[model samples]
Target: MVSGKRIADVGYKLFSGSMMLLTVYGGYLCVLRAQRYMQKQKQLQLAAQNESTASETIKD
Candidate 1:
């Protein structure tokens, strides 16, 4: 029969490794999605500003 200590140690290592991998992958995906969203937002903001500027210029 295996000792309780050995089982606990193995479980700890397994959980720790899985958690580390999950965190790394999660962080990478978050960064990728955030960048895409920010880029889209920036494009929308610039387009709106340009439209406003164009309207003002036409009135002058």
Candidate 2:
């Protein structure tokens, strides 16, 4: 039969491991969101530049 202390230790380790995994997963999601936001900002800037150039050409 397993001792109570050993059982408690195993339970604690499992909980800690799961929490670590969740933290890592959360960080990965955060990085992906930031990357997407940066990409969107770049596209918006490019679109704005294109529009301005188009307008200038029309004026000319």
Candidate 3:
């Protein structure tokens, strides 16, 4: 039969491992979201620049 202390140790290890996995997964999601946000910002800046250039050409 398994001892109580061994069972407790196994349970603690499993819980810690699961928590670590969840933390890593959460961090990955955050990085992906940040990347998407940066891309969107870059696209917006490019579009604004293009619009300004187009207007200037029209005026000239």
Candidate 4:
């Protein structure tokens, strides 16, 4: 009976550790996604600025 309890405890600990690892990995992915999003936004803003400048030059 005691041996069975010990096995159960070990299994639970392993499962908990795996879950924590997965959570950390998920957080890392989210940071990468946010960085990509910010980079894309910056590129779009720069493109718009360039377009406006070109239009102004053409008008002048």
TM-score of each: 0.70, 0.96, 0.94, 0.94
Model 2 bad stretches (over 4 Å): none
**Where's the lowest-lDDT run of ten residues in candidate 4?**
1-10
lDDT, candidate 2, 33-56, per-residue tens: 999999999999999999999999
Clashing pairs in 3: none
lDDT of each: 1.00, 1.00, 1.00, 0.99
**Residue-wise C-alpha lDDT for candidate 4, range 1-60, written one tens digit per residue:** 569889999999999999999999999999999999999999999999999999999999
lDDT of 3 at 41: 100
The regions of model 4 sitting more than 4 angstroms off are none
Q: Can you write out model 1's per-residue Cα lDDT over 1-60, one digit (the tens) per residue?
A: 999999999999999999999999999999999999999999999999999999999999
TM-score of 1: 0.70
lDDT of 3 by residue, 1-60 (tens): 999999999999999999999999999999999999999999999999999999999999
Worst 10 residues of 2 by lDDT: 1-10
TM-score of 3: 0.94
lDDT, model 3, position 44: 100
The lowest-lDDT stretch of 10 consecutive residues in candidate 1 is: 1-10
